[model samples]
Target chain A: MTTVEKIKPLVLIVDDNSTNIDLLVNTLKKDYRLGVAKNGQKALDYTEKHLPDLILLDIMMPGMNGYEVCGRLKTATRTKDIPVIFITAMTETAHKTRAFEAGALDYITKPFHTAEVKARVKTHLSLKKAREHEIYIASKIQKTLLLGQPPRDINGIQIAQLTIPSQKVDGDFYDFFKINNQCFDLVVGDVMGKGIPAALLGAAIKSHFLRVLNELIRLTDKKEFPDPEKIISSVHSSMIDQLEDIETFVTLCYARFDMAKYLLSFVDCGHMRTIHFHADSNRCSLLRGVNMPLGFPEQEPFKQTLVSFQPGDLFVFYSDGLTEAKNQDGVLYGEKRLVDFVQKNAIMESKELINIIRKDVVAFSQSDIFDDDLTCVLVGIEKKSTSQALSDKAKLEIKNDLTELARVRDFVRNFCEGIPGFPLDNNRINLIELAVTEVTANIIKHAYGEHTGERIQINALLLDDKIVLQFYDWGKAFDPKSVPLPVFDGSQSGGFGLHIISHTVDEVVYSRDKKGRNCASLEIKL
Target chain B: MKLSTEKIGEVTVVTVLTEVLDASNAEEFKTATAPILKESNKVVFEISQIKFMDSSGCGTLLSFLRQLKSSNGNLKLCRVQEPVRILFELVRIDRIIEIFDTKEEAIKSFKMGI
Candidate 1:
């Protein structure tokens, strides 16, 4: 093949005798590009500058002998993989044995055989390429495991997660286990170190935890989910002996959420604290756990903290990879930034919120790949179901008829029933019922204007010691501000409708919503 | 709607016997008690039996009070229960009417006229 048409494999030939170098160069020059180094020092320097496919060295040199050169090359990470072959005049078995002891792939006797040299070099090169290909396939398999599809919504909790592994494989792992319809357990963990060993340890811990959880579920006669603290303690105690022998430990956070009671119980085994954002009050707080990392001598019992979560609440579980993420200028994306981002975007859906944060981190760090595994899990309690709903809010839709007014009144009455210290008495219920009825009657008369098939939706929520009622209608909208208060001097007959409604409720508001629908809301203080 | 009337000197004390005075029966209550307002210039409504009331019920009382005030007389409420009192204060209707804890106290307010 012409030199310009085909790329050639590089081979370095090192020797003190010019005649011996000429012999090997002539034999290998046609098949490979040749680089010559007369002594051991030049050979090492040439390999350092440009790695070659093979090196042929003479065992006897004036300074820095071939055996010493091969030993030094094998010690370095960069040059260790270069195949080395020794050439010597001594055909004694001891001399050849010494050459092999110093890290030679093979030794050539003085009467050089060209066929043997070519065959050995070709065999070792093919073997090295096959090993590299195996590593590439292994990395691809690990990536698929890291990026497995996770369900977006589990029960009433919306979940969003992201993991940006730093290498082909990672030392971080996260998983979710569904216990029942109303409960599930989730975990996020980081092994003690990075690379292949850490990755394997992470995999082992995950599979072991899953097996134990399923076993506990199977052994139970009564239907009860495994407690997070119990699960952590069991895993830690079981894996402690093995981990200590390897001189490594894992930091993990395991949590279980009960949708029926809106409670989240979790234990942190030397992991980062979990952050909670309360939608009711628009405040944020950290939930901390007190325990050593798994595999350490049990300093304290693994304690779980129980928190009452409400609808529209957010819980953020993340690894140190996110907190220690550095920008181009080497500044960390710390806790304050994360907290502030969550506070501003708490109103967003869980997936959208996570995407925004992920994008921001990427932009701030100025790189798509992180220096460590960037792992985060966001859990959000969706707004409660409004139909048959008895939480802080109740919503209902009905036709624009006077008969539907009674059901609306009942809806509001049932919502006001359990509010502590509020006006749930008979007279108060009647007053609220009357006020709502009057407002509905007006909407049916003026807004709908005889199209009784149209619908009106009402949503009631209790906030800040006041019961706020929101009325939504798709009919013709009107501004309550333009409507003058009726004259109650026993002269005006028909305008008393709005007067009675506005006076009975604490506050009244009227505006058009984003969908171009009329929204008439009222609030009554407890 | 049930009602019982007794003459307490110059004031007629008409007691509401039904526990509720709401839209379901406020019109009947107004029709049934029309003669009581005309029977005496000064009247006292004994509402101790009223456990629930609404805007229509409040309108019924306002109509009677207006009729008495035009004739240089007054209408007063007595034995107003706590829940009904809250409804009155919430709507600011309590500012126009005099409320008392007992029938004797309400009747005395009109008789003394101080």
Candidate 2:
């Protein structure tokens, strides 16, 4: 149950004559909250400050007539829905018609029978309250859908997004989805206009995109992610009929970030060109868009552009609201300012950069209100730490399967070879490889119970004339000391694995963490 | 590791066709010859192609010898390369399996019925 209790509906009585106001006040004061506006301008100002459920008007005001006041109220979007009832002395049919034309909901003669006035006011107030409640619920649902939880980071890419709606429901939205463990997709879109219609279209387009993506994932090979161009085209095709029916178009940009290759492939559908800030060069470049906005032509060929990213590189995707935002002086905050801002702050974190850009735009516009919905998505590629770049350390993850034993050996050998001071003679490297293979085999056979998807993470470090290898697994706990040493009598085929692992390394230890993860550390003094 | 076999009078002669028999290729060599050892009691391995052998390589040979002997058969090594011969001496593998200088000598030992 809602905590706040319902108070009586407020009604504004606008009349030039005090006697008429008193008459209305005495009739309704006990039942409603009341406001008195002596002239047309005062009534407008009062309505602007506080929205009243109903307005009682007199047609014979001095400066601005009741018809003019009603006309102004009907024209403004915010107050147009508020019901206005004209109470006047004129009884002619022409006068009543004029009252209706001026946006009055009901009319009454000047005598103003108490019963008639009360009944009309009560009916109009109830109708207004019902409509407001309906809109409030609709806006709440739209808000939750528009701002659903989006991933902040996927793999090594950092994502930050900002959306400011011009109305209760924004037509602009951005989304983030992980295609796989190493690949993620970032999508930003803008519908043609604002408010309820545009918002519904935005939701429909988002749902369509998700449906098409799921279909593509199901149909394609497991190793292959959905193609960005094909996804856009499919979503566009499915939504074209509805979009045409609504007679609107949407601009969208979809980019897929591949963490392994450090590549970004994207399709821009007549959207604002995305900005790329190159960390190495400290320069910003706008990516080219090659296709028309969706829901336009039947078969617009969607071409995607591929860009390679380096560590510390930043990508900015935004709607036109930022570029078209104007100051009090009517100067547009153009693309140049955005480029300059990004280039200057390219070294900052992705979230910080997004926040600063949002603040800058607000300061430039000199107002909190935006005429158009504005949205921005910032993605940053992580930079390698200095120690990681200098040290001879490598981390590898492999499936818990025996066939991957060879791969584990290859990874360890490669890491040992990277040490400049120690070539790590073939014999020592061979022994290390054997120990790694044995450990991995044991994990696959014992710890994971021959499971395939479970992962074993091995971190190899060559530090201070020693080689240390640490392994972690979220499988069942394993006690190295509990495994009896195998007799070296040359006939034991199965138990030799653990014995060889223990003898090959200088020191071996195993323990389980509080979270039930198994950690094994092995060291070799070379 | 690659293998080729020739049969003469119920004795199987298998040759390893690689220069090095170290850790990387040792397991594969064992896998390739396990079926042959399981089938034949009298087997001869021509290892002249192997110039180097590591401890894993020696262990694999010992395992093969043990498996063969348990099945009432015997294994002989012929055309022993010098590096492999040194490895065999280091591991004292020469005392367990018969070693010969040529494939004919190994085949003669298997056929001598001693």
RMSD of candidate 2 to true structure, Å: 13.4
Candidate 2: global Cα-lDDT? 0.79
Clashes of 2: 0
Q: What tens-digit string does per-residue lDDT give for candidate 2 at A223-270?
A: 787789989888988888888888899988989887756789999988
Model 2 regions more than 4 Å off: A1-5, A27-31, A39-131, A192-200, A280-283, A320-347, A357-374, A385-526, B1-25, B28-34, B37-114
Docking class for candidate 2: incorrect
Instruction: List model 1 lDDT by residue over A1-526, tens digit each.
Output: 1231256778899999999888888888888799999999999999989887779888899999999999988765456667888888889999888888888888878887888877776776666556444444434534654333445435567889887766334567788877665677888888877666677778788877977787777877657766788788778877888899999998988888877567889998888878899989998998888888888975476889899888889999998888878875669998889998999999998889999989988887876767678889999887644222446767899888765766787898877764532335555566677688777767777788878689999998877568899888888878776777755554322455567677667888888877879888888886
Clashing pairs in 2: none
Candidate-wise lDDT, in order: 0.78, 0.79
lDDT of 1 at A303: 87
CA RMSD per model (angstroms): 15.3, 13.4
